[model samples]
Target: MKTLRFVASVSFGKDSLAMLHLLLEQRRSLDEVVFYDTGAEFDCIYRERDRILPLLEERHIKYTELHPAEPFFYQMFAHPVHSRKTGGVHKHGYGWCGGSCRWGTTYKNLAIAKHLRGYQEKVVQYVGIAADEKNRIGDKCYPLLDYNMTERECLAYCYEQGHEWLEDGVRLYDVLDRVSCWCCRNKNRKELKAIHDNLPRYWERLEALEAVLGNMKGKPLNEVVSCS
Candidate 1:
């Protein structure tokens, strides 16, 4: 019988690196490694991925990049710029997403599913939950857990694999434990504070987004955390 095809879901994070390493170590051939480009991610994530692209080529791994039809801003603000209310028009407003909202993930994953539709082989999606984060693990295979690897091991693997790419100056996990969109409501107090400290303008921009939306208490993402 033919072997199953593996598809690793990567976020350019520690756990992602560990899982991919394990897969390759197992002599498993990957059908593809998919990275969902949310377009709202930190710049460093892209930089790290760019650094590793050459390695993927050297390894002859098929790396795929997928993105939703609309970026985060456009997805959040679905209405047209032109409006009778504003006379001229506004480029942005709001539609339906916040910290509690999983709509953005849903849309992105559904787009990926469209790509996954044609595969004939049994495909396994590799997720990057660390063994320590087993609670978050569900039906998906947590390679870290399967390999008995912890988050620390994942970090070490990435650093060893690409120390130059994994620079201390701009590692996302250094500032934020979890990297997501800049304006995600899911960001905790520390992450928000990190945004304010390292990327003050971005934080201001997020606040500006809130200023335009005008529904902080009434909604999820409209409220900016007190970075003070």
Candidate 2:
């Protein structure tokens, strides 16, 4: 049998970070550490990601940055816009995610798996959904659920060494409980308002997106960006 490659999927979230720590603590080797940059995440997420990168390198782990064929906006939204007047790069063939317009996490993982499979013989992926987040768990989950790490513990472990979740964690955490792609329609009014309050430029970007896309359904495209 081919040796199974261990790959950890991190989104710069508490659970994923904790999962990585658990793997390291057990001395399990990681063939790859992947972060999918949809280019839609909040600025803080990228900042937090920068801080996490060096730490991984310090441990001799070389991380991978993955991107979809196009930026998240083009693939997820603009391409699917029904009207020609919208004016954005898009194709009219397969149906898009639609409505929610939230980029799928499954797609992100699939991208990593597909890219690695071309070069590697076998791959075993480690997902970071915490034990407490049962709703987020599904098949091929090898990190948090298998190891039984809870969300609370994930947060605690990531913060244990101080320096703000190993540095810069607190900066985003102080402003947002859990940073995600700032434009996710799942974000609540509070989160949208927070974006306006904290990052005015980003708020303007969302407003511009709204102008181009118009109502996602009942509200502007930006309204439903996330659940938060």
Candidate 3:
């Protein structure tokens, strides 16, 4: 019989980080930790990874970073797409990932899933969903929910352990609800306004992409933002 290998997937978000922390605290048999990089994540996400690397090394846990074969801009701006409806090829890449076209997430998931297939042992995947998010909990093992941890409690626990998402001297969780991809269209107006106000460099990149893409969520980027 093949041995079971426990692998944890972490996005470095509060819930994921807390789940890893709990796994460590409980002395769970974690063989590996996988992180999928979209290549468009916020600087803070990378910083958090740096903070956690030493700990993973100390614990002798295998740390694997998976990335899409194509860069984010290439996939979003240059990749060719077939148009069966028009019977013609669309020269431009898929626009901002929102509504029904979340190509970015699709790419991330495919990369992670493909990497997981390489394991010879039976893989037991661990997700970071919290107890509060029962709707998102599927068949995957969620250590956070198993421990009865809520999102707020997870964030608090991460802060207690000196883990934070900070960019430009600004605490990200203080402003945006999520600290994932800076260019994700799922971000709401409030989150966009926060980015425009706090992170000008990233905001500039957003503006440049918007210039090429023309609009975000069916309206012009500036019009969609229109921050006062």
Candidate 4:
């Protein structure tokens, strides 16, 4: 029988990197390292992706960028209708999820799996979800979760191996926690403030979206900047 092709999900962040490190350390023969670029990714993520490419190159690992079609939550909102209270506005907020639109997790994740349907060999999909993020796990899964390593173990292993690069200086204090779309409802107000204070352009774009979609109601990032 032919050897299977293993896919390590890469997300320009510490946890994913650590997972890759662990896989390599085990001498596992992986065919590819894949990243699902959900266009809504943070602006800084592009640069991080480049830096990690060389590492993959040195290891002869094929790195692929996977882009999703319109985000999976396209059906969440109705067509924009001008409202007297909000004035002429676009319904941009329709896609924003609260606890109600839990679809955010399943939809995007399934989309990512759908995007990776090409490598048909027996496959092992390495997800970056850590043991600590219990809430982040879901019912829909890749079938290979049983053999996967958790984020906590990945980090400790990276540290023991002297990988300072994994120390991604982001506020989450994790090298492995590479989250996308700062405006995501899954993120706390502190993370949102960080985006506003550090990446002004992204913050402005999100604010303008709020104006059109009115999803945030009257609450603005400026109001909670200090707390974050």
How many collisions between residues are there in candidate 3?
0
Q: What TM-score, to 2 decimals, does candidate 3 have?
A: 0.95
TM-score ranking, high to low = 3, 1, 2, 4
Q: What TM-score, computed on C-alpha atoms, does each candidate reach?
A: 0.79, 0.75, 0.95, 0.67
Report the error of model 1 at residue 77, Å.
1.1
lDDT of 3 by residue, 131-188 (tens): 9899997777988877899989999999999987988999999999887788988888
**Global Cα lDDT for candidate 3:** 0.88
lDDT of 4: 0.60
lDDT by residue (139-210, candidate 4, tens digit) is 433222344556656656555654443213443334223355545656566667666665667678777767
Model 1 spans > 4 angstroms off:
1-3, 79-98, 163-168, 215-228
Off by over 4 Å in 4: 1-3, 71-93, 102-107, 134-178, 224-228
Candidate 2 wrong stretches, greater than 4 Å? 76-100, 103-107, 162-170, 174-177, 220-228
Report the C-alpha lDDT of model 2 over 1-228, residue by residue, as the tens digit.
787777788887777878887888887878778898877776656666787777788888869999877666566544454457677635542222333543455567678877777764577778888887788656665677777778767777877734252222225555655666666655556666666566767778777766755553456545444543
User: How close to the true structure is residue 202 of candidate 1, measured as C-alpha lDDT?
Assistant: 74
In model 4, what are the clashing residue pairs, if there are any?
A: 14-175, 14-176, 15-176
Candidate models: Cα lDDT each: 0.71, 0.67, 0.88, 0.60
Ordered from best to worst lDDT, the candidate numbers read: 3, 1, 2, 4
Model 3, runs deviating above 4 Å: 85-88
Global local distance difference test of model 1 = 0.71
List the pairs of residues colliding in candidate 3: none
